[model samples]
Target: MGWFGRKRDPQDANEMLRQYNEAEAARLAGLSSGSNLAPTTVSASFSSAEFAVEDVFTITGRGQVVTGTVASGVIRVGDRIVVLRDGADVGSSEITGIEMFRKKATEAAAGTLAGLLLRGRVDVARGDVIRTSASA
Candidate 1:
């Protein structure tokens, strides 16, 4: 009959959850409008500026696998050739080696040249997206 004596019904729990989610969404939306989120956008990444498909771009600085859900990883300088089947998930593609520089010339399209590990295939077109695996 008192405060401790009342059991929370499912409807009350659902309402509480809904309110929490709405509040959280509002907070995140506000935060994203600030500067910190700006630097992480794709347009802010080196990939957008430094890479060009069919034109083999290079980065002098080092890179880490900061974020990924890769099946395998490799870095080939030239035609060292670590082939991946089209549409293969990040976890299934095998990266046979690492190539810091292409001793010979290699080519890639701006959108097709993926990350350092070749995390995804050179298959993402101008506007396609491959998300990091949820479990990764």
Candidate 2:
């Protein structure tokens, strides 16, 4: 847990990457062996959630509520996430709730402006990037 609430292991990231690579290779394998197919390769992975924190505040009974834009990937309520500042990992927290336009949501996707209620003690500021512990 390192001064923060939780710490992520590099192995987890490696496992996700491995799975993505295997899936991509399998998909491409079929196309290349076909009689009339352009042996094309498409790669994708649930790398992480990139959010540019725009505001940070604490709600009386809800802990810290962070409003930001999901720059990439998707974030769901109950996902474990980390706060990053200046390209360094700071702390980890779980998403307690998600809200958009005053309506509760189960998930928020890239390019959406959403507010995430985080449980745990966090010291986040504007411009910080919130990334997920696992692929989202």
Write down the TM-score of every candidate: 0.25, 0.65
Model 1 C-alpha lDDT per residue in residues 1-136, reported as the tens digit of each score: 6779978556786688679868855764675577474213222222212221122223344322111111222223332222222333323222222332232223333322234334334442322223322222
State how far residue 19 of model 2 sits from its true place (Å): 43
Q: Which lDDT tens digits does candidate 2 get at residues 1-136?
A: 5788798656786688679868856764565567475321112246777777889998897699999777678888888988888767789889999998789999999767789999988879987888888634
Best by TM-score: 2
What value of lDDT does candidate 2 attain over all alpha carbons?
Answer: 0.78
| Candidate 1 Cα outliers beyond 4 Å, as residue runs | 1-11, 37-39, 44-129, 132-136
The global Cα lDDT (0 to 1) of model 1 is: 0.32
The Cα local distance difference test for each model comes to: 0.32, 0.78
Best by lDDT: 2
Q: How close is candidate 1 to the true structure, as a TM-score?
A: 0.25
Steric clashes per prediction: 9, 0
